[model samples]
Target: MKKFVLFSVVFLSLILVSILFAIFSFSLLFSQDSGVKEFEENFNIRLPRGTVSEKIYDDYSGFHNDGVKLYKFVFTPKGMKSFVSYIEKQKDWEKLPLSQSYQALIYGGEVKDFSGNVTGFGGFAKEVGLPKISSGYWKAIGDKSVITARFIDYENLDIKTLINLNSYDFYLAIYDTKKGILYMFHINT
Candidate 1:
């Protein structure tokens, strides 16, 4: 009877902890556009919808939207460091089935508290006065493998899209290469 009670208590505790973690994670991601701030701070790029002023390309992943073509994702130093480390450690990456910059942003997410996730912190100080995102990070997956979704970058296309990842199941491989920071776009059917 004691063992049974202990096991049950442990199980319940685990479940409760999971729930709390989920809530905290969602709160961090969903509250006050934290992901956007993260992007702005890390990479010197701005992906404002309805405004594509570049010749976008995604031959590697073949990821593109209807009008705008999104191919490469941008990365930050911290983000690049994390990515390069992960890739160098494994030398292989797994592509997921999620589209949208916001979804891609969650790839190397840190389990920071509200402050860590926030735009300004000690180690994670928010990047300021950086020019909007220009050319982002690019990769040669499998020597040219068509992956999940679409990528868009045009010189002009007032493209206003709201992208949010409801759950936290997206992950990306890290690499330390010429591509400083890493961002991803899905280009699949």
Candidate 2:
């Protein structure tokens, strides 16, 4: 009887420990300052477990009825893979090739220095810290990285179509495998 009781206590202790760990993990991901909740609420997509927000930018002009939101998140390698897999399985997202035209569209016009030399695009995307690919930005994702967007017929569309988008309403997720970071950009007008 004592042996059985000991086993029961051990098992119960293990279960309790597991429950606490799960709670703690959940809290860490969704904490007020984590930005996970806001991102999930706005995008209707939940980031992978163990992901943490690194930076966020929110701009809105309710009067003008247009705004942009950008979020940067760092993920564990495993979490990054998991997110890529999840996005791949989602019907709404379309993987986009990492092309110069799309990069231009995302970054807007070329930025120029005081001497009129082209620097790079200067916008909230720059402010949010999207990797600067124009100057060989190493942090910028490459061919191996997954780039996915939504709200357009990407299959039949070309870069020109993306460039011509008037009221840009789209969601883009770019994964940096080397740095294990995910950059999300959203535009609504």
Candidate 3:
């Protein structure tokens, strides 16, 4: 009787371990890149290579007209430094340029520059401390541009309505100069 009980205990333990392992392996294989892949497919743009995505928030219904999806990507200290260097080299890139389809979706007037005078976007300003706007990469780019891309689908309608779909709206590449962290905001549907 004791031998049978011992055998049952070991078998159950092995089964439990195997189940947990399978669950973990399945999650690792299927769940890792789903959000990033969806974003790329929807927006038709690729995120910068080597950066790690920290969190993806899909706000189906929120304060905005429609909704907003926030994808926060983090970079290592070394990677941040390298990206800043690369941006400095791309002086004539004209910051963020919205594509033609993106342009049609804008409900309001035009996209504006949200950088100059302000230290940083969202919580980064306080997090990184107040950076010297006149020195380093900040000074290189005279005016920091914040381009808004608000996407709306007017498929079968004769007249278009200015409804904010909030899907794949616009992206902001906010860099924390002091900490070398780039906050890439993808406001979308």
Candidate 4:
């Protein structure tokens, strides 16, 4: 009876800890990204009104800079339908991020002056602080390819995992930390 009770306690504690971590990590990511935060405000993202600006998105590095229109998700204060249309137009590239996206992500590496061969999870792990070996874990998920990388949230001590990229072979799957949604980018090189 004592052994069973102890196991239950341990399991319950782990579940509780996981829940706490998820809440905090998602908070951190949303807080950091104004766009994501804006989306969470009302379950919808209302982009600022501009001259149809373009951004070169860097999915892995997490930067909002760059100048490209593909996968841009453009929108106006009162023009989200168009935004949806824009998103739909690029459905073709949904299979994998555009080549420019990959370039943008790599460019982020240059801008940050980070040195490493593997940018997806390997770089994200070191950046998040989940022990060097804990990163770049490829799961044997049958035909489906899943790559889970743990990132240490400096703002919070909890770790976050990026899961299921969808397109391409790489996918970001995160656990215990929020940031549940994945921002995927393509690698040009």
Which candidate should be chosen as best, given lDDT against the real structure? 2
lDDT of 1 by residue, 48-139 (tens): 42221222333334334221123233444455455455444442232322223322232322233333442211210012111223333222
Worst 10 residues of 3 by lDDT: 137-146
Error of 4 at 7 (Å): 2.9
Looking at model 4, report the run of 10 residues with the lowest lDDT sum.
136-145
Regions of candidate 1 where Cα sits further than 4 Å from its true position: 1-71, 94-176, 181-185
Each model's lDDT: 0.33, 0.58, 0.42, 0.30
Tell me the spans in candidate 4 whose CA falls farther than 4 Å from its real position.
Answer: 1-5, 21-73, 76-189
TM-score, model 4 to reference = 0.20
**Model 3 TM-score?**
0.39
Sort every candidate by TM-score, greatest first: 2, 3, 1, 4
Question: Which segments of model 2 are wrong by more than 4 Å?
Answer: 1-46, 84-97, 109-124, 133-157
Best by TM-score: 2
State the lDDT of candidate 3 residue by residue for 1-189, as single tens digits. Answer: 999999999999999999999999998876645545544454344545566664445544755544444444466666666666676775532232223222333222232233332111132222223222222331111111223441223211111222222224444344455555544344433
Mark the 10 consecutive residues where model 2 has the least summed lDDT: 136-145
The alpha-carbon deviation from the true structure for residue 1 of candidate 1, after best TM-score superposition, in angstroms, is: 67
Predicted structure 2: lDDT: 0.58
Ranking by lDDT: 2, 3, 1, 4
TM-scores of the candidates in the order shown: 0.23, 0.51, 0.39, 0.20
